[model samples]
Target: MDFLLLDDRTNLKLSIIRKLEQQYSFSERKDVLCEELNISQYLLERSVTEINEDLKQFELIDDMELVEQSSEIILFQDAQVSSSVVEEKYLKDSLEFTLLQTIFFNQFTSIKKYGEKHGMSRTVVYKIVDRIRKELAQYEIKLSKNFQLVGNEWKIRQYFNMLYYRIYKDSDELYNQSDILAVQELFSEIKLYCEEVNTLYLFKHYLLITLERVKRKQHYFLPNSFKSVEFDQKNKIYQTVAQWSERTLKGTNREIEVEIRGIINQLSVYRLEFCDLENDVVTEYTERLKQQFQMNMQLSEIGPEFCTSVKMTIYQHQFITPLIDLTLRAIDLEFFHERYPIIFEMCHTFIYQLKEDEFKFSKKSLFFNLLLVLSQQYDEETDKNTINIYVNFTQGEKYNRFIKNQIQIFDSFSIHFQPVIRPDTDLIVSDYLPQVTFSARNLIWLAPPRASDWRNFGNEIVRINRELQLNKKRK
Candidate 1:
């Protein structure tokens, strides 16, 4: 025979979830529960399974019924799995709420009633309650969330709460004083800074002051008034100070604009500088960045289509599985990243490859062409075979051949060319070559129009006809 014990934590969770039956979702409950309980998702799931089994043993079917009736658990599977986690989560949220209630509202009875109703020990309730109060007190006088301290730097009131909790835990005055005067001092300074400069740094200064108090615990007592406090709003000392000293000192604003202009001018003046390189390296690196950004956008836009489409199974089996695991792990790793080291390495490797190839542009051109074709052919008919065809066009030394073949398939048209820039190894054309232009080239780079505008091309053709007539006359 198995017996189920209704623990304080479990009871608190049930009460909390029932109260917030409308606002919270099953998934959110599960996540919050796991976090509060300090348990892994796997462990949380196992606990919920065990709890359900226990409930069945005790004939507590009504509890299960109550949960099922709650429409917040819209999906049966999610509702079934979330029971234990939600219970744990609710207990934590309740404790946090109770702490705030007791500290700010002076509603200490709520904490006592909560514990008594849930059959929890008053001592245990007080312990949890005290912890939250201590946390808030650390923030000092800034009790409300919206009453943010702004100066040369602004900080949220919550930061002060955390700070007070840290510094005054052992101090005698912390328990004696109901109102946190130290926190108020910082907040007042923030208000003054905001009034004068409309700056955010006052908050930062407040945090620094809090940190200093924490560092020197003996100097935790606040004086009646500060000497440097300004009497006037339009004081010359406050007006002269720059709001963002760090940015002004760094001088990155001027440098960035200058660098951007330099890059654009280089591209405009020497377009052939890109063409004087090998194909493979340049194409592989630049195409990777372009494809990565494109893939991200496509995934965001067509996410729902993947779930409902007939090719969902095929996409999951062939495409998503290969990348999703690594991608998710990389994202998780990014949260704790000090400086995005791995992505930086990938960028470095890509840039190095580009430099090694001596700046080939055709590879990038072919890559762009492949993307354009892929984007255009993106439909229900685009199976693995169709994708492979485009992929092969990008792979190896097949790009030039692929482009030339496509050009041949395009309709023939009249064209003329003149050498624009004749360097050591390559001749960059300024004018169209005679009888060389085709529908494919015209369509391929539709925006650029190869060398000249359509109107200019017509004028050039007319000019050539007159020149031919004159030469015939001279003959």
Candidate 2:
């Protein structure tokens, strides 16, 4: 057994590898794997090599291998190792990572009990607890003396739900199969009343925890301020959940009722109206934003997809404020404020309009969602007539600052410029274009920027825009 210090990335890699191993044989393209893992090809290859080395130590040689790789595809094969062996090895080697699982899934009441069960000294357990506390602090959650998680209950549930997925992602027994199936059936019945994606897994985990707590005579009481579903709707869902639980868990009617009520309360916090953005209020708000920002976009140009995003943002803020708080906490505010200050400021102004109690949206949620929507909308406008431009510069920090300023200017005119080479590039705007062959249609070279360079560049951009429009008209 080995106790390795695992960063989040490494943990994710191991989980990915374990999942791949379970399939025994599968063919995935390199690009597809990279997209799934949110890593580059080079990083993915390195991770596979590292995972192979780890597998070797456990005498699982030839158990998993990348059988083939090419420009278009990557093939993986596993030698069909028994489930027991893999589960045993995973549990032994990843015990530290499993500590949170024990605390969460088992509802351990005290640090001493956890230490005794793990065969670790109290001091070692405390250190681990301290580390967990630091992690929880990122979400503004507190670990209490009774080994309880204290925070906005919604945030607590979200945190634990995510943690559960990460820890058991590779395991077939992540949740009881029957329980998951039950949740799926319940969701199908109630699908018309809510809009959700991949929520069954989380709901199953919630149900499992609720049942465990009930068995131990523990209860979660909803606050008086909690807004539940309408009585008739809640009762219908409660009856369905109760009937399923009675057959599945053999829970008493009273106990099942309590658990159903708790589940419904949590679900209410996440249920979103499918067509909320089609209303006049959201349309009026979108128009106000365009005028305030001096954007050239018309109401129709913003599209239904953008409107749907706005509705989700509103729902998140109004019903799932804690999730929005968690998202804001994860953002690098200072970096965005520095690089995209204009957009950031615009977000603030837009958020201010939604500050009324009726809207119930937090400033942070509005700012984050508004920034995302505005940036995408601006990019779409820019892409319509402008060419993609990849920047090449040598002066490091100074060049970086120059590029950021250039992006801001280009954005104002709805002119697209990549400033970096991405998969789909159209032109190069650089201090000096590199000699390497490129598929882009044009290149605009320049000396290092001077005070008048922006004016000259703006004029050139306007000329190009007119040329593109003329080409379109001719076609």
Candidate 3:
């Protein structure tokens, strides 16, 4: 079913609705739903309201209400309509969503084919195609006359994967139980190399997708280098995937290799250095980085765990696809240059020496990782008075000067403003909150720091500083 028409919030609402159906009529604790769904109470409350508004359109129910009491939320479903009817109505409303998925997967290659499959008239198909075209345009993708999608292949795949996850929420429903079991078995054999559940799911999803695409006679060309040499030849994880493909797929070795590479590219499977690459190579690169940066610390200084992490990062750059966007990374590089110019210069020099084109895609991530390693060594000796603040502003030079002044005035706070929000930030002093979720308890929302705003801003800063002190004391 084409559930992409329903955004994540709406999908979450429907999930809640379906859960309510199972209960028939009962008071379910909000915490239970929140824990199951991994959503905040604020988000659950908001989704409930939006879902009821949508339900009202079908005249299926008066409204689904969650009556809040002490430590519990009571859910009341409309008895007038059965849960199955509500589900069917939603499925019927989601045909356009399904159509988009069909187009993306190259399942239906023409308006006539789509119309035939869905029992829709030519006129209706044309309208849906037009809407799809407009939507693709927003992503700078093109919908051609024959229903083929024309765009950067990675971006096309990205959009498809995003929509797929938004609709299904997970990969469990995308494949049959047998196929899932097969993939799980393969994952188990190599679980020590990568044990993350999300990573396993992603690998399985792309593997299934790649198999389907290959069976449909859709093939990707392997570059001469990847085909000529067996990359990560000694890696057990690579060996496992390659062996599975040989036994399961009906293709030549070269074609199977291409499919395996395609899955790797789609999943961005880095952090495989545990099984790939030699220790000497990683040590050489690590030493070069330290020398270029003129840092006194050695690889051993950061200890074994962090040393492995840096090596994995270096290995990851080798398989990265070029088309993926690094705009945020570019912003991070700029911010690091402004805040810690010397360290950023060292990173730039080290990356330049590496001379790998793929480094362009991940130099920021590398720099950040290197920075963390350095911080581990240096932070122990440094005082803990400095608070890291992330400033989000775009007034150009004015914002720059304002940040400089703030850093000087609030010397105890290490102010680092960027075009993007960073996770390591102690406080967010932004002109406007970006449409992203953050968990900072000390977010100071204010206009650009003018002379008049400083008093109130300073008060907020003091409160946060005190809170931090209290937290430290409790710890």
Candidate 4:
């Protein structure tokens, strides 16, 4: 995650761009802007020049002014390209980024030789490697004396997967095209359904690692946490991947099983639905927790779906390193844990029942996940969004905030303002049409919305929330 962050200079330029765009005046005096960014006018002007140069790349097609200094005021607009594209460009340009991908692919490159070919000093190369080595050490991985990643081979794969998955975003940047196709084909044949985010790239990263290691005659050493673990070899996906591994690796059956168990373990843990899994690990864990609730807590009101979700969640923490931090979203759970302490206690007590020898159960992961799932059940505010709305006007961020504030005066919990467009967005209020296609719905297009526009918006909200209530009642 540290590696994904841009250098301070690049970060400053982006911050400056965002700062100017956020101004309701839509322009900032050069001196004021420099003061706001805590930089000298000289550096500010040079950063602006750099920004202009990058914008010039699209100048042939982008006739509209995106970023400019009109006399004393620094004017900024959202570029035709997204912030992500800008970040990706900066990421690829980084020497540290290149070195990381180099190590991931080549595995054993001489840094001095690499620096020589790249016109960088040996000191600079090792400085970069030292930074990487420190980060890898946090994950219990070693950047070995041989310049290869060493440790639990599975963890090494996870470490790189996190790095590549964050940086690449499914681009052909670091993956083999054939491997993507084959993995996708296997997924289709198995009819796997996993709702965990970024699963496509997960398959890509692991498959690439598997192919690379297998081709090099490097058999994976199974982690102690997975020792003596049982898997449903009869599961269609498991059998399919196993057969593929056997045919491709041409290794002893034991080695092939090791690969299959490792891969399948990951695939199963992230699955949104495991009713199809022959072993149904979640169901087993769910049943155990349910018995505990019945005998100790005298509580069986927890839904089957909720029980399964909680169990699968703790199960995953045992094997998977968290791909992202989502603490803020689950903050409400802390209140619940304090108020209904027994629910939290029941969850806490159930964790001790887990296998001491095989599973690496994370108490914190379980706590966070319980918070996330339980929030929907107990936090009444979570259901307040009956008609989610995203306000984006040509007038930009400051104007959007003003409009959102005005809408809040309505005192309607049913009409929640979403920071971003979501699948359930009932309306989008903007002055100009968006550049992308969207499902046709209530779209208010008004530069200076009149009294009539407000009336129409209110009508639309009432209609949307009524339908929502009706649907809920029917359910």
TM-scores of the models, in the order given: 0.23, 0.47, 0.46, 0.60
- For residue 328, model 4's alpha carbon misses the true position, in angstroms, by 13
lDDT of 2 by residue, 22-56 (tens): 33244566676778778898887777676667667
Q: List the residue pairs that clash in candidate 3.
A: 2-98
Candidate 4 backbone collisions, by pair: none
Q: Which scores higher on TM-score, 3 or 4?
A: 4
Runs off by more than 4 Å, candidate 3 = 1-51, 55-96, 104-124, 131-159, 166-169, 176-181, 192-199, 223-230, 264-270, 274-383, 386-459, 462-475
Candidate 4 residue-wise lDDT at 74: 51
Which 10-residue span in candidate 4 carries the lowest summed lDDT? 323-332
lDDT of each: 0.32, 0.55, 0.56, 0.61
* Model 4 per-residue lDDT tens digits across residues 201-279: 6556666777666655667867654422365666666677777777666477888878877677667456533323223
Residue range 126-217, candidate 3, lDDT tens digits: 87777667666655678777777776544455455444433344546655466667667767766766667346444455555555555555
lDDT of 3 at 355: 62
TM-score winner between 2 and 3, please give it.
2
Find the candidate with the highest TM-score and give its number. 4
